[model samples]
Target chain A: MATFAVDKTKNTIRLTAMPKVLQGLTVITVLGLIVTLYLGYFNAGTDIQQGEIQRIFYIHMPTFFGAFTAFGATVLGGMLYLAKRDDKWDRLAVAGVEVGLALALINLITGSIWARPIWNTWWTWDPRLTSAAIMALTYAAYLMLRSGIDNLQTRRRFASVYGILAFSTVILTLVIIRIRPDTIHPVVIGASPQNAQGSFEATRGVVLALLPSLLFYSTIVPITLMWYRIRLENMLDVLEQKKIALLSEG
Target chain B: MNTPFFSVVMAIIRKDLQAELRSRELVATMLLFALLSVLAFSFALELDRLAREEVVSGVLWVTVIFASLLGLNRSMSIERENDSIDAMLLTPIPRSAIFVGKLVGNYLFTATVGIALLPLMTILYNINMLNLWVIATLLLGTLGICITGTLLAAMTVQTRAREALLPIVMLPVVLPILLAAVKATTGIINNAPVSDWQTWPQVLLIVDIIYLVLCLLMFSYVIEE
Candidate 1:
């Protein structure tokens, strides 16, 4: 039952409640707020050249960076799982993708909302926005791929491989545009300054807001992961108990 | 020592081709669905003159994508239904060979639609559709789509919600291919300068290779169950 339930067979130093984990979350939130406030203060007098609501960049750029980092982590986790074939590695891959997928979603939503005020439209196929949208969608598909398979082993294997393959599309996002630049989205480099998509140049305050937000994000992901793992093991335990009870009754 | 890798590839490819030819079920369904999609979009778009010119690429690609999804879904579903996939697994072939062979089969079927759609769409839209670049992009784009789609289809085939789930998972994963293909094809249509299509071919091709390699490595794991 313990094997099926918690999987923590020979518990080393079981303290029951994980105070540090709880305290970790609280500290992340508090620090995130302080950093955000500091960012807002630093941006006080500096105005953006691209004009419209440069203020939003404080929130937006960090989200993009953090999301990219999470995706990078997801891909890395996928590689690790494929090499190691450990469920622990697969768990980390899932954790990274889910959190990364969320941040990517937020990046898209906030970018669109910000675009409305800046670009005077809800959306533009700007390279950054279009690529980010595709990234979110790609990883979201990675989630569905995970869900479609119920066998724990196969699910982990296939999803991790798919996750690794996703990096190709990210490459496609950059190079494909460079190869065929005449479409709607602006190119970020090489041809002309005019071809550049939304600027990612980070102001110092943008950096402040960005750093804490990433910290907040990184902190939340593992806890959610541990919680999900616990639930999964608990569900398995209940199933085992029912099976055992039936056998004993017979 | 030589491993007979090439022979293994040919054998798997031949087997898959033989299976599809014997069945003839997947291509027939795909062709019908492809025709239906093109027809629906034609009527829906109402063939406005400028509209046809402007949306030529969109109309052509969407039809191909949706039809290919139907074919991709059916390909694995049929294998599972007949337990052929399991039987195939019983063979002593390397699982990676199976992945490559399935990809070849998928590309053959999808590319047939790609070739057929050229004249069909040209006639329907009343535009000159034959061009070197157009054909090149068609081949490249469909290959990119099939490369990933085959992998996704195999993964989704064993699931309970097979039908509804395959495309939802596939489309998102292939967004880059879709975006690049559409953009490149659209550029070709507009007769834009070469500078216009400088990146997509390279990007799409790189993506195709990456998926091809990754699919091979992971396919053994996928079918192991």
Candidate 2:
């Protein structure tokens, strides 16, 4: 059993134990990640053109979806925080940003690695790449601005609004390949742009390997990470309140 | 008695304009900054006539964006220092009216700087930046920038970092506007056919409307006590 309670007198949150669900989810996520990696490395068929470097695609594309899931939690958390004025929702929103940024970084690194052999460069200023870079920066700015404010309520309110607005960058990153005809980034699901480089068909082996990776990344990874982050934040709150209490007593 | 929405908006706008006219501080700083940036770009790039035509659109938008950031930070900090925002919130007029008023004032000042940059850029870059399409793109782009900037500046002004925080947060949000504006300006300057570049301005218009509606709806929440 887990205990998460707010003590009004001390003005702090007490979270005594990790929830069973979170622990179970963590185990499942770790196991799922390994299985997905194995499937990606061993089970998936090699691309006739690109060879083994293409294996990074399984991690590359799904981590973006992972980022998508995390940032979506941010938008939902932000909206709910604003409507209900709940600090827990605000915690969820910040957790979303931190997790989302990590996943987005993974997506970028994997893409860069994959691009070296496929696109023949470590990076390009394609629309998808530029937007993804900007998307990461936007959320990073969210964390910076959130820290600059000291007032709890005001910080929550402003962060909620900023978090909600930052989702626009995510949406733009996801759709830029579709809209920009000049991009050379590959599109796996639908028709690649006439100029797209390293485009590939999503064959059965590709789908079989990608589906579980996508499922684990988009669902379990972000959720498990965010749960731990939120718990850590609650502990930090308790520490902050204790410091304030000590100062007042002194 | 209920204050009419338009009248309230107009009154706030009038108040900001009147204050600006008396001091002439905001526009003067932004205009001076805009001029200096153009000069800096020209000296730094050292581009010949052909190269200038390719890069001048980017220079124009970048200058405008930085100038707008200066004006927005100044405008919002002024409100914060004087506690005028609180007084405005106390009034019965709609909260969004305050946003619209500040947006209009910021837009006008930034747009003036943008328009004035046209002839100077033409002279400096040796390209005809006085085209109608370029001016339209300028207006549409600035409106979108001001919409997001005003909302963001309000939040940043309350933070410890103040002016420095505004650009960090606002820049990425308004990047699509910057890209579209630069593209449109580049196309028009090069005299490209409408089929090639019309989509950029249309994108600018759509993004402007979306930001406008979003800022209006979100303004009251940001300013709440």
Best by lDDT: 2
TM-score of each: 0.82, 0.95
Complex DockQ, candidate 1: 0.52
Error of 1 at B85 (Å): 1.7
Query: What is the per-residue lDDT of model 2 for residues B16-86, given as tens digits with 9 covering 90 to 100?
Result: 89999999999999999999999999999987878888899999999999999999999999999999999
Clashing pairs in 1: A178-B199, A179-B197, A179-B198, A179-B199, A179-B200, A180-B197, A180-B198, A180-B199, A180-B200
Q: What stretches of model 1 exceed 4 Å from their correct place?
A: A1-29, A41-43, A46-53, A123-130, A167-250, B1-3
> Best candidate per TM-score, number?
2
Give the range of the ten consecutive residues with the poorest summed lDDT in model 1 chain A: A11-20
Worst 10 residues of 2 chain A by lDDT: A3-12
Per-residue alpha-carbon lDDT of model 2 for A120-154, expressed as tens digits? 89988888899999999999999999999999899
**Judged by DockQ cut-offs, is candidate 2 incorrect, acceptable, medium or high?**
high
